[model samples]
Target: MFHIETEIRLVGPSMKTIKVSSRIECAMICSNDNCCSSSYDTILEHCSFFRDCCPSKEFSKESQTLTKISGFNPPPKDCSELPAESCSGVYVIQPENRPSMTVFCEMSIDNGGWTVRNDYLHFILRQRSYQVRFDLEDFTGNTSYAVYSTMYVGDESDNYKLKLTGYNETAGNGMSNFGGSSLSGMMFSTRNRDNDIDERSCAISRKGAWWYQSCAAANINGVYSQKYSNSAVYWRSWREKNGQKKTMMMTKPKP
Candidate 1:
């Protein structure tokens, strides 16, 4: 979730640090600091803090390092704060083989789009993981995959705080090559396929998997989505199906 990296450190900006006995202890220090987003641990029993919670920099494996999110322990019900009917954002589920291509239409909120696809895009927030039964389909409602895969969530953003951020499939069909590549072991990302910027949206593929083409994308409230996967993924996906398609969610015009 919190982009944990070993043998690396945040180079540009920093927040604070605490001396801890182990790498996990370093995470504990970050967990207590609200301002801290990303954390790094040195072999010298010191933990480094970063103001930029989401470290965009590359991790250097040469250094002794271990990093993870500081605070993410929330009850399943905590996600209840999100709207039950629709999501505040949209997300795309990409496959491993295509890399840059989205396997399913984007999920968003619109004129009751979520209601129509409830049967296929079922989301349930569990005690430890947010689960989604993702049934792939095209804008015309044509089935891309007859059956849905039960996917566990992961790879969350720093603006949001929900554990198990990586949108991964822990069960069901393990992985499939139907659309392009196997779904198993894929990681989540929110970076726009076009701009390569995180629209604060959710994405699920495998870690380190690269996309060749930037076909389409979406935007999402990291915090709200974590608290409300049903509304976020369902409605966003629906909007995409309805032809509100784009490489990314269009930036709302300023009033």
Candidate 2:
């Protein structure tokens, strides 16, 4: 799925580099990009992306300025060319408990309470989160998307974000292959790993209440759950509980 290589440059067919928040974010950008094969960067966030080549540790690097780079295998350009499929899956909506549901990758959303316009999808979670299983190629070729709209950032410190990824394994990078599939970031999985819904999937959290907690004790105070690194999937979609809302964006790449 992904390989974390350090202090090396991947020289090959190149694409233009743009400013990103962190090295992990940069790596993820490359991972989602079918045209990008590897990523290289330093603490300054000066990153380079390659298309035709994979990660390599054999490169000239000044001994003192040692830095690590993360790489992932991006899909082919034609991956998303497929049309949308029908939204076929078991959807359970209960007003009593947290409002949750499951969706599949090949399923269409026209009548599944999901709205699509232009290139973005929109939906609402009155009191909780949801498990969205759509191929990454369809949404936006990347794991992260711009916040088109949000209900409220109740707690300033809380993170209001969404994740397009696979199962949560407490290991390197906090992600692993789900259902024996190598597709890591775009699978639609649920908070309840043991649920009847698919476990090999991705998730979106507009505002969450620390649902899938790795912590032993409940966090009474609305605080961001335990996290490892900026790029760690465990903390990627973590959200505050007070004021929860659901709204996401998907940007279509230029032809």
Clashes of each: 28, 12
Structural similarity to truth (TM-score) of each candidate:
0.24, 0.26
Candidate 2 lDDT, 1-255, residue by residue in tens: 112233344444456666664443454455556543434343344555555443344555421111112221231111122233222111222222333322211122212233211111222322333333211111122232222222211211222223333333221121222223322222222333311123321222212232222221112112232333221222122221221112221222112
Question: Over the stretch 1-255, how does candidate 1's per-residue lDDT look in tens digits?
Answer: 122233343465666666765434454455456544434343345666656645555545432222322222231122222234322122222222222211111113222111111112112222222223333332343432112312333333322112212233322231232233343343333334321223333233211122111212222222222222322322233333122111121111011
Q: After superposition, how far is residue 186 of candidate 1 from its true place, in Å?
A: 38
Candidate 2: regions farther than 4 A off: 1-6, 31-34, 55-57, 60-208, 212-255
Best by lDDT: 1
TM-score, prediction 2? 0.26
